[model samples]
Target: MVDDLALARHLADLADAITASRFRSRDLAVDRKPDRTPVTDADLAVEDAVRAALAEHRPGDEIAGEERGGQVGAGRTWVLDPIDGTKNFLRGVPAWATLLALVEDGSPVVGMISAPALGRRWEAASGRGAQAGPPGSPEPISVSGVGELADAYVSTTHLGTWVEHHSRESYLRLVDACWENRAFGDFWQHCLVAEGAIDLAAEPIVNPWDVAAVQVIVQEAGGTFTDLSGERTFQGGSALSSNTRLHDGALALLRR
Candidate 1:
């Protein structure tokens, strides 16, 4: 039987093949979901392909995906966000990626994120730690040691999301407290926190599939992952990833 992290990596590879091919294609099919979010043929294609593989390899496991949805119930569930930055893909930007996480009994134990266009991927298991970069020679990765917000670099998915889901003023407070900040939207920003490139990443709103993998990678990198309210669960509908030392300070500034 394939190991859980290995299966997650295989799913990422399967997703990368589909996303990389259709990424900037002029004929890619794009549709709007009920929430007015864009969904591409690539998104559906990747999730369906992944579900098929999970069915064959881990049939008893539950599956939850952005496109074809299921619940992350008791026991093991494979969580997927086929294309985490669909808007970027639509705009021909190379920041898009496929995110996969293995949530066992509601907690993420393994994560695999593949951004083939960026020529990078990140993976982490509960006890294995985090690694990212080239396909074959990836090295260990961890969060920065920056302890103070004044010396830290921060990132967020979108400024508009803060206004809609949380307090924009709260986010601005964090940006103002940090040394530098960027709108490094989506999965990439959180991965940046995991790699020590950035100290914190905050998102005002997110779904389970959006952050299950992020939660795993960030924690494995020796950072902290939590909702804005400071609870460490991916289901919080919001997220904050930070180097361990700076999390509480970042959270204090983002309090509603």
Candidate 2:
């Protein structure tokens, strides 16, 4: 089981090499899918590299990547979002990351998030606590002690997403209830919740790849992850990460 975590780390390292090199390249290639989201050359390259490494290291494991589009079914599936913040990557925002999660029986047991540009990598296994920083030296992390929404800090990807997918009014109720808030979009906000930098990270729209690894890290770090409907599954179509003490309250506000 631990070996699977090691393989995920190795895969993150492989992705780092490709993403770091191409992050700000003058000649980086960008394309658009039917959804109008940007896909950079680095995104495709990192997924391809990680897929190859997994083929050699864990031949029997299945892979589902943002670029390649495979399914996570009733077995061990390696989920990959080669670049969790592709728009950030393309625009050189420094908040993008390579997200990998090992899902078994529909739940992620091992999660690894590598944001090389920020020089931090956060990871967690099902029974192990979460950790962050470089692989050379890691430190265990957990959620904040804030128990009340009025004293908490919160975040989300974008206000526009709430309007488009769920309800911006509902998301605003969450923010207005908090002490402070930021847009801190993508994987970083959830990681912040895990490491206690913030108290809540909510998103009205997300794919499983967007939050699968996030679910594990936050949960292992003494937090909670669920959709607006309050279901604890990553495939719930939306997500909210919070210090466990504040999860229910946060959910109540978001559903307002």
Q: Local error of candidate 1 at 76, Å?
A: 0.3
Query: lDDT of all the models against the reference?
Result: 0.93, 0.92
Clashes counted in candidate 1 amount to: 0
Write the residue-wise lDDT of candidate 1 on 63-175 in tens digits: 98999989999999989999999999999999989999999888999999999999999999999999999776679999999988999999986778889899989988999
TM-score of each: 0.98, 0.98
On TM-score, the leading prediction is 1
Q: How many residue pairs collide in each prediction?
A: 0, 0
lDDT of 2: 0.92
**Per-prediction RMSD in angstroms?**
0.8, 1.1
